[model samples]
Target: MAKLVQFDRLGGPEVLTLRDVEVRAPGAGEVRIRVDAIGLNRAEIMYREGSYFDRPVFPSMLGYEAAGVVEAVGEGVDGLAEGDPVAVVPAFLQSAYGTYGDHVVVPAAAVVPRPAGIGPVPAAAVWMAYITAYGPLVEAGQVRPGDHVLITAASSSVGLAAIQTARHIGAIPIATTRGAAKRQRLLDAGAAHVIVTDDEDLPARVKEITGGAGVRLAFDPVAGPGVEAIAQGIAPGGTLVVYGALDPRPTPLPNAHSYPALTSRTYTLFEITKDPERLRRAVAFVNAGLASGSFTPVVDRTFDLGDIVEAHRYMQAGDQVGKIVVTVTHDAASD
Candidate 1:
């Protein structure tokens, strides 16, 4: 039997229930894995609250990423075998079949061979955080050498990854947080400049850092009163990428009647995973970076699978510096 986290009707984290399920053999082009660790994303919270882009299906799984070992491979599945370590990209079925389970059965194409040096815990933490950051900073934003990049909500896992990715691409990173407590942490995470938005003017600090030219790229997750503020920090013709909605309020765009035009976009990892080739490339890029030590998964906390309710409670507090993970025991290796 496989233990999985699921919910029938959702209101709060308390609605999640852990139940045992039978593990069936994989069908053609599918694979079965003994899950080791699962990555938790803010999207899950929105899904639970009935506010995400996708509506939840009752009795659905609630995880987005996981790392495990292949326990079985179905016919016609190439390049994979039992006992191989792997990381899953759960881009499809964003509303169902999440990673919070003891075992997962997914299409073979969605599985990526994980680096041997990276353990299940850290590997599970990589996909969503890095992909969200990589797509905006490298793919969409096109951050170039010497370009200034501004990141809002700089203390999050995706935000931290954006900072590091920007530095790797030789761009100058300016980060914004709610207060001064996270300033040192952001700096250590490779931010060249940090601003406490409440105390310092975000646009002013960004202009000062960029010699009044403004940043070439702005990545924002918090969208509400500061939407225009984020745009003001970006240079004319710069890209402003919005990926997550941490704030419940609607993000207001600059009134065309008053403000100059800027390229604004809302991006999601779903777009990158729409094609199998793109998904493969993204997974390869992330794994390569992980093996080379250019990318690191910042684990904020890990909860036992049974304590997921507490995990959600802690995540809602909004103090975590990076990814929150759930640890689970595999059926084959019960200790």
Candidate 2:
């Protein structure tokens, strides 16, 4: 029997329960994995609160990304066999194959070979946050050399990835957070300039950093009233792409009269994964970045499989400095 985490009803962290179940063999084109490490994201929190755009059925298993060793391979699966170490991509699977379990079945396309010299915990934490930021900064925004970039929520894992990516593209990475505590950390994390919004006026600081030219692109995860403030900071023809709604309130539209040529749009993984070619391209780009160490996943806290309740509590506290992880097997060195 495989011990797995499951939720029967949508509510709080209390709704998540552990259970033992028969481990089924994989079918054609599928592979079963013995999970080593699991990546935790805010999306899982939204899933439990029943507020995520994607809703799971009752008794659903919850997890999106993991790194594990292949235990069994079904017919027609190629390039992988039992005992191969791999990392699952950000593709969502059915409840039957969720990554929260000791064992899971996933399609071959959903698994990627982990790059050399990266440990399982960090490899497990790589896919979701890195790819989410990669799609916007490189693919959508078309960030180029000498462009000025502004990234909000600059302390998150995705926010850190954007900083490195903008640096790679030769763009000046100017990041923002609400407090002074993370200013030095973000600057050391590759941000060319870090602004504490609560301490200084955001738009004015951005203008000063860019020499009154304004940023040409803004990547925002926090939306709502802040959207108007961010919109006003962009150059006359700049673009604002919002990926996550940390704030529940509706986003106020950019003032058309103030900057008639400014453009803004909301983005989600759904839109980026809509086409097979685009999804394949995104996966390849992230894999390449991992191979080159141009992108690295940061882990702030790790929970044992049995300690998910505590993990949820820590996540809700909102003090995390990087990606939170869960492991099926304990590692003393993780501390």
Candidate 3:
């Protein structure tokens, strides 16, 4: 039997329950992994609250990313075998292949070999953040040297990924947080400028930072009344990519109506998974970045599997500076 995290109803972290489940052999084209570490994401929180894009069924299994070792490979799967270390990408349906468990069955195609010297914790932290940022900022936006990129919710994993990606591409990364607490941390993480949204006006500071031309791109996860301020900081004809809705309120388009020429789009990793060529490119780009040390996964804290509820509570508090991960212990050897 393997332990899994599941919830019966839509609600807060308190709704989550850990239960022992039967472990089964993988079906064709699937692999059974002995999970070592699981990455926590805000999307899971939204999913738990019943506000995310995908609706959850009753007794829903909720997780997207994890790092583990292959204990068994299903028939028709190639190039993977028992005892191989791998990271499960966020390319599977959460309802069918959730990773918040001691063992998980996932599509073999969604599994990527873990790089040498990277531990399970860091491997679990890489895929979602880096790939999410790479899709819009580098692949679609065509970010270049001298471009100014604005990143909101700058202390989150994806925000930090955007900051690193912008700097790696020679663009100036401007990070924004809710208050002064994470300003220096953002700077130290390679943000060229930091904006404390509660203290400084986002549009004003962005304009000042960009010498009145405003930012070329704005990567926002928090979409609410504050979206107007984010849109106001975009350069004429620049793009504003809203990815996650951390705020519960509806996003207003006041600036979009006023600045008709500006490009405003919603971004989701599901789109990347749909395009084979794009997914190939994104995977290659992130792999190179990780191997070259240009991209680093920042883990704010780690919790044991028993502390799942506390981990979710900490994530809800919104004070973490990077990724939150849950470590799972198993008898099998981890490569």
Candidate 4:
């Protein structure tokens, strides 16, 4: 039996509860991971609230990122063994294979050997944010050196990752936040310019920062009427990649009909994860960045696994500047 987080009916963080259940042995092409650290994402909150892409089944476990020791491997699994330290990539759907547990079994292909010297907490935080940023910025956008890139919601873990990823390619990252409180923190995280959306005119400031050329690429998670302002901030012929829908309002695409040759594409993290070749390239790029010290996950704070309710609540509060992590004590591993 293993301790896993489950929610019967969806509502809020209050719905999450820990329960002990029989953990099945690994099947073909699967591995059992004794998770030590779990990363918290706003998507988890959306899933809990029944607003995510996949509706949660009652008594559902929902998570997609973790790091831990490999406890066992199943038939046909290669290059992995018992006791190997590994990071769980967000390659699978949370509704299909949740990581929010002390002990969980997942597909072998979804596990990456954790880099040496990267502890569980940082490893747990790495894959989802970095890969999410990497797909749109590097692979799809094909951002070039010295190009200006706009990152909305600049204080998010994915936002910070986009900053570093842009810098990794010598591109200039212009980060945008709704308030001024996280400006310095975003700069510290490698954003070249930080914009306070509430206080400054977004397109005007972006134009001023880019010398009227405007940003060549924009990465945005919040898709709504606000996208019109973001669209106004992009250079002609530039690309806007929308990866999420934080705002429930209707998204207006000024660039599609009103602007000059501006391109807009809707993206999801699954674009890379679901493609074998893309996933391979992403893993290589991120692994190289990690090994060279160009990429490091910024963990804003941590909570005990038992305090997951607080973690979820904190995520909903949106006060954190980076990833919020959860550490498992494993006292219930024996359950």
**lDDT per residue as tens, model 4, 18-114:** 9988998999999999999999888899999988988887789989899999999999999999999999888787777899998999989889899
Best-performing candidate as measured by lDDT: 4
lDDT of 4: 0.91
lDDT of 2 at 54: 74
Poorest 10 consecutive residues of model 2 by lDDT? 326-335
Supply the TM-score for candidate 4.
0.97
For model 1, residues 1-335, the per-residue Cα lDDT tens digits are 78888888868889988898888899998888888898888888888888887888887877778899999999999999999999887566756457788887887877888887898889888888888887888767778999998989988989988888887788888888998999998998889999999899888888888989988888988777678888887787788888878777878876655445678889888877767776776777777777777888899999999999899988888899989988886454551
**lDDT, ranked from best to worst:** 4, 3, 1, 2
Q: Write the per-residue lDDT of candidate 3 for residues 133-205, one digit (tens) a residue.
A: 9988998899889999999999999999999999889999999998898999999999999999889988999
Per-residue accuracy of model 2 over 6-97 as CA lDDT, tens digit each: 89888888888878888889899888998889888888888878888878887788888889889899999989988899988767643445
Q: lDDT winner between 1 and 2, please give it.
A: 1
Looking at candidate 4, what is the lDDT of residue 190?
94
CA lDDT of each prediction against the hidden true structure: 0.84, 0.82, 0.90, 0.91
Report each candidate's C-alpha RMSD, comma-separated, in the order given: 1.7, 3.1, 1.9, 1.3
Model 4 is weakest, by summed lDDT over 10 consecutive residues, at 252-261
How big is the positional error of residue 93 in model 2, measured in Å on the Cα after superposition? 5.0
